[model samples]
Target: MALIDDTRAILGDLIAFPTVSRDSNLELIAYAADRLGAAGARVHIQTDETGHKANLVASLGPETGGGVVLSGHSDVVPVEDQDWSSDPFELREEKGQLFGRGTCDMKGFIAATMAMAPHLGDLDLSRPVHICLTHDEEVGCLGARRLVEEIAGWDEKPSLAIIGEPTEMRIVEGHKGCCEYTTVFTGLEGHGSRPELGVNAVEYAVRYVTRLMELREMLKGRAPAQSRFEPPWSTLQVGRLAGGVAHNVIPGHASVDWELRPVSDADHRFVCEAIAAYARDDLLPAMREISADADIVTHVIGEVSGLEPVDDNEARRIVSALTGANGADVVAFGTEAGLFQKLGMSVVVCGPGSIAQAHKPDEFIEISQLSACLDMLQGLAGKLSTAR
Candidate 1:
């Protein structure tokens, strides 16, 4: 059978599962496990605490050190508020594109890996080719961390990993780290008639927001002049804010959810410490004047660490060879690549569609793009066959 045939079939099946981050992906995990097992690979599943979501790892070839990993997430973003012509879980083909929720962002890559299964069965690989699929990638790359932890304990860890996020098949060697935080401010509430008698939580929140803005500017100004990233700099944004319920009363509490995208891990910590300092020195004392219980609480929503490009590693050479690109570049978005990198793998981000189509109402991957991805995976298989 043709590679495209298997990939499309698998893509159809994968999209059928509503593997939204908030939902369990056990169904999808089971389906993947079956496919991998049938393909003559050794499959192992790591489930979350509730045993609802799962991370599936399958290996083709020897169990010893040094191999390649084809990694992707099983979760898709929600389609609730989006307007779509068809159900998000159902694949729709039109004008040489496959329309579906996860097609581009990216069940397509998972399908491509599955398409390599038959070829893998035929190959006598000395170095294993491991396929790592995880859930909750959309929810801050959560599942991959645990999956990486599992991979770290393997008898022979894969030397390189390819994170199959949408990149039109170009090799992405680096990306920014994202750190999300939710902060809550507390104050004593009093009637609006005597504002001085109570601390206004909303007012403190504004100050906190203002301080964050200043920090954002400071970080932006310190960004290096050279970068392959789109914006080429770190960024910060306040995503949500909630507080008061009535106009005549001071809000006892206010909360803000914000995030920072840093160019490196060190930069991420620096920003976190900066926020912590601001809450302690500037906001807390003023709040305590109104009530001893008044305070600001800051906690991490989640963080995706950045990947720094490796210099002429085997992984880079393989990706460049597969994509036929003169060079690889870095992205501004966060990805699961850093986690694999944390496991001592030289990782790159390269896959089928454009990220522009991701998380949109009408998500899709071009037929040609899917074909290209199959070629890449197939090409990798050939490389392994020879390298072994």
Candidate 2:
């Protein structure tokens, strides 16, 4: 069968799994593992503490140096309120597009890798090819974090990790880190008539937000020279702030939902340290003086590392050659490529579709895009072939 046909067929089967970020992806993992294992590739499944979700790592050819990883998230965003023309879990083909929930965001790349499974043994490869399918990427890149820990333990490390994010098959060199947090304030409630008698949680939350804005402005000055990202700065936003039950009552509780998209690790650290010092030295002392029980807590939703663009990136170079791209670009969105890059592997984000279609109603990847991705993979095989 042609690679395109096989990719289409596998993509349909993959879409049928309906592996949303909030749902278990073990079934999908099992299917991929079985397929890779039958193709004489070594397959490993790393399940999180909850066995319901898993990451599949499969490799072909020798397990040693200079191997390349084909990576993609196996989970999709939800279709809860989306108005789709057809069932999101069922793949629908129309006018050269394959419509499904995960089609454009990621599953298309996974299918492209799977389509190459039957021919794994046909080539005498000098360097190996590895496929990594991770769960919970849409949520927080939780699965990739765990999967990288497993990769760290391997004696032989892959030299490159090509993250199959929706990059329109163009090579992407960098993206910002995503860090989300929820800060809660606990204070004593009292009559509004005597504001000094009690600590106002709402007031403190506003102060915290003000501090965030100060840091946000400071980030602009610290932006790396020649940064590729638009606005070219580590960005911050306070998504929500809530407190005060009524005007007459001093609120006992307040919470702030906020996020930081840091362009570099140093920027992330600087923001975190400044916020902690503000809370510890200034805010906490005053609040505690008023009420011994006054306390503030910060909860981390997720802190994904950023992929910084580098001059000596093998993955970018290889992908550029394969795709005939003249230069690499950066994106605002995050991907698990950073996690793999942390392992000292050159990482690049390149895959078949536009992210504009991801997480939207009737998400899709064009058949032409899939065909182009297959051609690139075939080119990669040729590059890695010992026969060359």
Candidate 3:
């Protein structure tokens, strides 16, 4: 079909930009804004603080309420160490798959949505169709959070939000919320022979990490019996730990990076409070006894709220109707869906490609998957056009 060809062409252009999360994505965002704008959509660009990156929100058809939003992140994970047979930034088609860095992790959905832009102007629609493209999603969904805040201030709120994360075209009803933290432990250094005169930061860091492991177990036990989630429990892990320069010298500084993926807000709060209580009541006393300067500090680095499946979710119903899928799923990885849900918009995570291919080397999306996505968007367009 012509639309499928357009989608592939757009996907190629998008893949060429290499919008890695660590680098600026202004080039890609500008390209998308221009394309969508040229298609007779009203485009609004939300630039980041440095103006090096942006989020694009474009609407077609009516400017009123109760429209559908198609959302996708523009950034891809880094390809620095991955073993790729072809240039990760260059799109290569082999057999029935289109290979590139962002093809599966997402720009495929973005491209498909953009390909449908021209048709939006022609559709005799009652409610508008909105495109929400954000940056920095690979890095803890920072862009989506900002976009959600911007959306919150809009005059006309959308009725539903479909985050085009790779779900193999399945309707994703829920996923876990991820919160990351870095805890720094500081102590007074002294010679190894005079250990009592110095506070050992490494030792205390180990103790704190041990406490985190205990919390992990506590979270595991908090899983609800009726939960549909795989593993069916909230999880915690200390991903990175670094401390101590040399064995002879008493180490004075240590840092540990940890994360919690909570199934519920209560579990999230419980985990945070448990860590704080342990730091305050147990760790601080021992450290202060040696030197007043010794201390522990924890900072939240990244966080994305979890998507809870609602029995009567509007977004889920809309997606199921469009895709003709009666059942929904829960994913282990995080996406921007939760943020939209928090903004009072019903949300579903459904898109082409398998997440198993996401963030891996030689990432590719099957051409058939892209075709399926285009068909789904066309179905949505038909629905919006007749909704009056």
Best model per TM-score? 2
Q: Which candidate leads the pack in lDDT?
A: 2
Tens digit of per-residue lDDT, candidate 3, span 1-388: 5999999999999999989998999999899989999999999999999888899998998889888899999999999988999999999999999999999889999999999999987887888889999989878889989998988888988978899999999999999999999999999888999999999999999999999899888888899778988889999998999988888899999999999999998999998888899999999999999999999999888899999988879888877888899899898999988898988788999999999999899999999999999999998888887643
Report how far residue 190 has shifted in candidate 3, in Å. Answer: 0.9
Off by over 4 Å in 3: none
Which residue runs does candidate 2 get wrong by more than 4 Å? none
- Give all candidates' CA lDDT scores: 0.87, 0.92, 0.91
lDDT value, candidate 2, whole model: 0.92
User: Could you give candidate 1's per-residue lDDT for residues 141-188 as a string of tens digits?
Assistant: 889989888878877778988889999999888888887889988888
RMSD of each: 1.9, 1.1, 1.6
Models 1 onward score TM values of 0.94, 0.98, 0.96
Clashes of each: 0, 0, 0
**lDDT of candidate model 1 versus the reference:** 0.87
TM-score of candidate 3 on Cα atoms, chains taken together = 0.96
- Against the true structure, candidate 2 reaches a TM-score of 0.98
